[model samples]
Target chain A: MKAITVTNPDDPSSLELTEVDTPQLRDGEVLVKVHATSVNRADLLQAKGNYPPPKGASEIIGLECAGVIEDPGTTGRTTGEEVACLLSGGGYAEYVAVPEGQLLPIPEGYSLSEAAAVVEVACTVWSNLGMLAGVREGQTVLLHGGAGGIGTFAIQLCKQLGATVAVTAGSAEKLETCRKLGADILINYKEQDFAEELTGRCDVILDIMGAKYLEQNLKSLNVDGQLVIIGMQGGRKAEINLGALLPRRLSVRGTTLRARSVESKAEVVRSTVENVWPLLDDGRVTHHIHTTLPLADAAKAHALLDSGEVTGKIVLEVGEV
Target chain B: MKAITVTNPDDPSSLELTEVDTPQLRDGEVLVKVHATSVNRADLLQAKGNYPPPKGASEIIGLECAGVIEDPGTTGRTTGEEVACLLSGGGYAEYVAVPEGQLLPIPEGYSLSEAAAVVEVACTVWSNLGMLAGVREGQTVLLHGGAGGIGTFAIQLCKQLGATVAVTAGSAEKLETCRKLGADILINYKEQDFAEELTGRCDVILDIMGAKYLEQNLKSLNVDGQLVIIGMQGGRKAEINLGALLPRRLSVRGTTLRARSVESKAEVVRSTVENVWPLLDDGRVTHHIHTTLPLADAAKAHALLDSGEVTGKIVLEVGEV
Candidate 1:
């Protein structure tokens, strides 16, 4: 099996396409022949030696992939079935072994490359914005980082769930992308203060920039508001005004997809398949792929995201069956 | 009607026993002849003008009272029914107008004074720990300010709900009180570090100390722990490490019972009556009142609470009906 391995974690050029032993399938795990996998901020962090995979997880770079079930090690599915999956660090390879529960059938009419992008953003948005925060219909939700992979999917999904979506993005082009995805209100964070610009306080906020946006995010929250923090792209620590939170019944929940128990990841996948799969099958929430490159150009994918201009996800395609 | 009025916002001695006009009952409201009421921290804050009553609420300074219904304004109970009520304001008065929804029948085998102590603590604990946090059996909950009104009630409630309760208090005597209420672990905040002394991480924390304990509370929390901030006895602001929180899947929620809308308060009241009143009736959770004083001596009660020696609640008893 060929996989992307890091020679010097501190260097972007450290990632190299090299031959590695294929992972053996553990009990309740399945071996998948990966068709494609996408870059995530987690992958960049892992490459930099800042983020390590959880205990017992594969030390590979990617967090999600689309693949065919080569060996269903446990019960659920048969060989040769198409699937997309959330992963705990094995997706940067031709073959990866994962717990069967983390796999989802590729939605009808979607390409494998498209499916690779879907599970990561779909599960991230659905779990954080939908499951944890419970952003219901008719309520308002403020989504930060509106042009990224998670942001693009989140805007469409939140709108589909009957919420008034407010988004903050850096560029007019990114904001335009959010607008096309049914974002009701768009704020160019570089220009306007989201707290001041947003008319009504948001019922829910999906925050990626952690400490830098903490206070303003709190100010923008309506009574009984929920703020779910999945990514900390900004600084890590900030002063939280508890006086504001208590009176308004505000909740701050912090989450990550990779470190969670396999059962929990499975539950998120199951529901994402049940709920967001249909939206993907139709044209309502299309995959927003910024660019695609062959797996050997993993270094290029990292550089593109590091430049911070990618509109959505960047995928790495593998050799076909 | 006689009530406690603050002559000067800065002076604790400003709490004066004086005659005030009887409150007129609004639609779906009930008027009660006060038997007794309890001194909560909010009363002190309101007396000092540090905390103001919510819109359209009484200017009088009390939160919970026990009384016989003088007028059941719209429906539910008849006049002369004994009830303990959660009030927006006006609980300090001899006569108070409350929405019918906030009224809870006095549990059998308990006096009106006991009932007065129950509603405030019960509603606070139930709404924050039970409802919002969803603390279930087999989970461990760390309760700060375990000697205070909410703490004492929460310790027993958490115990009755099959959770192992850990508590932190200022004094050994207060910790002893918590022990009797089935606190499985006790950490004297003045002597030991709760973060180090606590045997295991907490699944839920009913927190009153705000900024001062925020870091330590996060440390004491287990993976997926929930810290519910109902009071800010410490300071209101603190630095939250989103870095630590995201990896652990921790959630921090802030809430207050007083300023919530009538319908929301009613929902808390209804759930308290349904879930907690049974525990009270069965004697599994007993109301813990440190002392009961004459209503005219509210100044003395406030002074005692300010001295920070009183364990559990201090009740103010009105003159005979």
Candidate 2:
């Protein structure tokens, strides 16, 4: 099996396409021949030695993949069924073994590479926006980083839930993409202040820029509002004004899906398949792929993500299953 | 009607016992002839012109009272019924007009003066700890300011709900009082560091020190724990470490019950009467009073509270109803 490994651990150019042994099946686990996998920010962090995989998981970098079952270990599914999976690690290899419960059949009529992009965004949005923040109908949602994969998926899902969606992006092109995704209010963050534009109206805010936007994110919140932070693209430390927070009855929750227990990850996967897969199957939500590259050009994918030029997801086609 | 008026906002000595006009009733409101009223920290802040009453509330001090219903308005209860009430203001007067929904029947076998202390502490604990933070059985709760009204009420309520309660106080005597109230873990905040005493174990934290304890309170939380801030006694600004908060999956909420809408307050009152009244009736929860003073010595009551020598609560006996 061929895998993408970090040879230097200090530079983006350190990735090497090297031959590795196939992973063996554990109890209640099945092996899958990798078809395609998408690149996430966590992959880049792991490549640069900043983020480590959870204990007892594979040391490989990928977090999600779309593949076909090769060896079914005590499972009901037959051989060669196309599936999308959420992995703790080991998604970067040619063959991977995962818990049977973490696999979901590809949505109707979607290609394998497109299904690879669906699992991460679907589970992230479902767990944070739907389950944690409890986004409801007739409420307003303020989504930051509106051109990214999570942002694009969240905007469409929130609209599908009968909510009014607001988005903040850095460019006209990005704002246009958000507008086409059914965003009700669009603000160019470089040109307009989001807090002033939607002060005292937002019921939930899906935030990515953590410390830099904490104050303004709180100011944009109405009473009984909740702000869920899933990324810290900005710096980590910030001053908080409890005086403003207490009187407004605000809630701030910080979470990430990468380090969760595999059981918890399986729960997220099951929920995403049940609630969000139908939206994908009916054409209400679609994949937004920027570009696809061969698995050998893994370093280029990291560079493109760092440049912030790509909208939506970037996929890597591994090989024929 | 005789009321306690602030002759000068700067001096506690400026509160004078004098005659004032009785309040007129608004729609959905009832008038009560005061038998007793209790003091709160908010009353002190209002006297010093630091905290102002909410809009449409009376300018006089006092937050809770026990009295006889003078006029029932449209309520089902007849006149002259003994009731414990949570007031927006005007509890310092001989007569007060309150929303009929805020009225509670004095618990079985409790005196009027004791019931006066119940409304403020009961409503505060039930709203912040039980409702907002969602404290449940078998979880651990860490409460700050263990000697005061909210803490005393919270200890008993948490114990009744099968939770393990932890408390912090400034003196040995205060800790002893908390122990009798069913606090399982005791930390003298003056001599011991609470964060070191209970790190990564608290399920919910009911905090009043605000900025001073923000970092420590967050450290005290276990994974998926919640910290609810109800008062800002320590300070109003602090630095938050999002790096620490995100990975642990913690929630921080800031709330205060005094400035909420009448409809919202009615909902909280309804929940309290339905869920908490039974405990009071069964003798599982009881009011703790430290002293009683004549209503004419309202300024002396304030002084006793400021001195930090009083334990439980200080009641002002207004007159015979």
Candidate 3:
């Protein structure tokens, strides 16, 4: 099987297309002929030796993929079933083994490439905003990186949940993209302080910047508000005033989908499929693919995503669709 | 009516018994002729002008009292109902007005003073452990300030919930007290590093030390663990490593029962009574009162509690039982 492997772990740009042994199917796992996989920030970290796959996970570099099962091992399932997978690793390959629980039916009418792009973002957003924060009607949600893959999907989902959506992006074009996706308040973080603009108003905040926005995110929340941190793009440590949190009944939660156990991943996949698939099928939420490239160009895809200009997801086509 | 007033806001020791007008009931309120009121740490802060009562709450000090209803305002209830009242303020008086929803039935086989001691602690522990943390059988809970008012009660309640209880206290004797209350693990905080002793073990932590233990508390939680901060006895600011929180999927929530709305209090009161009162009725959980003093001795009671010599609660007997 062909896979994208980092030729030199020290250099993320050294991603190379190379021959690797096909993954063996473990019990309750199925071997999938991967059609498409998407790039995530964590993939770049793994390529640079910063992020490592969880123990017993694939050493390959992708968090999500879409394909058809080639061999249904141990588990009683027919081959040739189309599925999108929430992967711990091993997605940037022609063949990947997926635990049964991590599999989701591709949304109705979605191509494999589109399905790949939405799997990670859909599960991440829904798990945090829906499962953790319990975002619902009449609430206000502030989404950081508003035009990015997770943010774009989160904005749509929050709107679908009957919430007022606020977004922070670096430029007018990104903010415009968020506006088209049902965002109610748009703040160009380059010019305005989001915390000041939405002071004590948001019921939930989907934060990616981590420590840099920690204080501001705390300040932006209303009484009983929750801040869910999924990434630490802007560094990882900051001073917190626990005093402020008590009187306001605020909660700060930190989570990573890739770090979750197989059972946890299965639960997230099941919930995301149950709650989010309908919206995608109905076109209420749409996949935002910035670009798609051949699997061999995984390095280029990583570079493009790192440049930070691309909106939504970048996909790498691996096998026959 | 006679109430304990702060003779000098600058001096918490200046509590004096004085004649004051009886409280006029607001709509949906009931006036209670106080029989027993318990001294809480918050009362000391209020006397020192540090803690202010919530809007529309009484300006006097005291958070919990057990008394008979003198007047059931417009809600159409009979007077003379024996109730354990959760109050915002004015408990250290001959008469106090309480929102009807904040009333709890006196636990079976308990005296007025015993009932008063359990009200705030029961509501606080139940709201955090039961409603917020959802502590269940086999989970591990860490209670800080073991043998203090909240800790002594929480230790027993966690046991009733079938959880493994760990506690951190300042002395060997306090730890012994915690062990007697069914704590499975006891750490003398003065002699041991609790985080080191319980690293990645606590499913829920009821914290009071705030910034002082913030980092350690974060380190001591298991995956999917929740740290509910109900008090900030140690200073309020600390540096947090958000990076550490994500992979473990930890959450930190801060809450003060006094800061909650009357409706929220009602919900908490209702839930506590439904779930916890049964434990009290069966003697599975018992109130621990260190001592009871005449209402006029509130200043002395506060002094004793502040001295950290009193375990359980210090009750101030306000009127004839």
Candidates sorted on lDDT, descending: 3, 1, 2
lDDT of 3 by residue, A140-248 (tens): 9999999999998999999999999999999999999999999999999999999999999999999999999999999999999999999999899999999989999
For model 1 chain A, the run of ten residues with the poorest summed lDDT: A7-16
For model 1, what TM-score is found for chain B?
0.97
Most accurate candidate by DockQ: 3
Where does candidate 3 stray beyond 4 Å?
A: none
- Which candidate wins on TM-score? 3
Candidate 2, residues B124-218, lDDT tens digits: the string is 89988877887899999998988788888889999998899999999999999999999999999999999999999999999988999999999
Model 1 has fnat of 0.95
Q: What is the lDDT of every predicted structure here? A: 0.89, 0.89, 0.93
For every model shown, what is its TM-score relative to the native structure?
0.97, 0.96, 0.98
Candidate 1 residue-wise lDDT, A1-321, digit = tens: 899999786685688888889998889998999999999988988898889899999988999999898998876789999989889998889999989889888888989998998889999999888788887899999999898998899999998899999999999999999998889999999999999976337999999899998888888989899888988989898988889888889999899988789988999988888888899888788899999988888999998998889998999998742
Candidate 2 clash pair list: none
lDDT of 2 by residue, A86-117 (tens): 88888888988888878987998999999998
Model 2 stretches astray by more than 4 angstroms: A74-79, B74-77
The candidates' interface RMSDs, in order, read 0.7, 0.8, 0.4
Residue A300 of model 2: what lDDT?
94
Regions more than 4 Å wrong, model 1:
A74-76, B74-77
Which DockQ values do the candidates obtain, in the order shown? 0.88, 0.85, 0.94
